[model samples]
Target: MKTLLETLGFLALVQGAMGLLHEFTDWHVGLVQRVGLLDGHEVYASVALIVLAIALFAAAERCEAD
Candidate 1:
């Protein structure tokens, strides 16, 4: 459970960073730009993802693996 949360947190961090990078530069990477639902709100979604990742990590730390 911890490992899963950590992995998810890492992925979210990477995606969020990549989204910001792509928006500010010509990187052309990350999944943010590929979502039709996001449209012009990728940055906000990326930030939200980062926040969710943090919460997930905290929850993981408080959980007891079976």
Candidate 2:
């Protein structure tokens, strides 16, 4: 479970980075653009995903310490 959480966190972090890139840079990914979150606020969705990634990482660390 800990490993799974860590993997998920890592994936989310990557996704958030992609989203940020898609939003700020000329590079655009259709998948991230189609999220339809916050009425097309990709930045919000990306930030949310980043927050989730952090939480998942923290949870994984806590599990390991237990």
Candidate 3:
């Protein structure tokens, strides 16, 4: 459980950072854009990613505490 939470937290943080970078910068050459996952709505996708990252990190912290 702890490992799972930790992994999720890390993945969410990395993806969130990537999303933000792709949204504001000219770095639109990645798997996310390739598959049209966050194609048109980069802002929304970035926001969702940031929220997910925060939640995942919180969950990981809680799991570690327990």
Candidate 4:
């Protein structure tokens, strides 16, 4: 259980970081533009959701452990 929690925490951190980069930098947008979906606001919203989900999952895991 401890290992599972730790792994989840790490995954959450990685996902959150990716989301942050996507939202705050142009690098991700450039990539998205190349993929031809750049005009869609849904992509950005999904990234935001990923960040929020990771944060909430991590928090929940910690609380459960405690």
State each model's CA lDDT, in order.
Answer: 0.87, 0.84, 0.70, 0.56
Lowest lDDT sum, 10 consecutive residues, model 2, at 30-39
> Model 4 off-target regions past 4 Å?
29-66
Please give me the total number of clashing residue pairs in predicted model 1: 0
List model 2 lDDT by residue over 1-66, tens digit each: 899999999988888888888888858753566665555788888888899999999999999999
**Candidate 4 structure quality by residue, lDDT tens digits, 1-66:** 656655665665555455456656745633333434545564564465466656667766786879
**Candidate order by lDDT, highest to lowest?**
1, 2, 3, 4
**Comparing 2 and 3 by TM-score, which wins?**
2
CA deviation > 4 Å runs, candidate 3: none
lDDT score, candidate 3: 0.70
User: Which stretches of model 1 miss by more than 4 angstroms?
Assistant: 64-66
Quote the positional error of residue 32 for candidate 2 in Å: 2.4
Candidate 1 residues 28-61, lDDT tens each?
9999988999999988988888898898888788
Residues 16-51, candidate 3: write the lDDT tens digits: 677678767868643344447656876676667678
Find the 10 residues in a row with the least total lDDT in model 4.
29-38
True-vs-predicted CA distance for residue 29, candidate 1, Å: 1.0
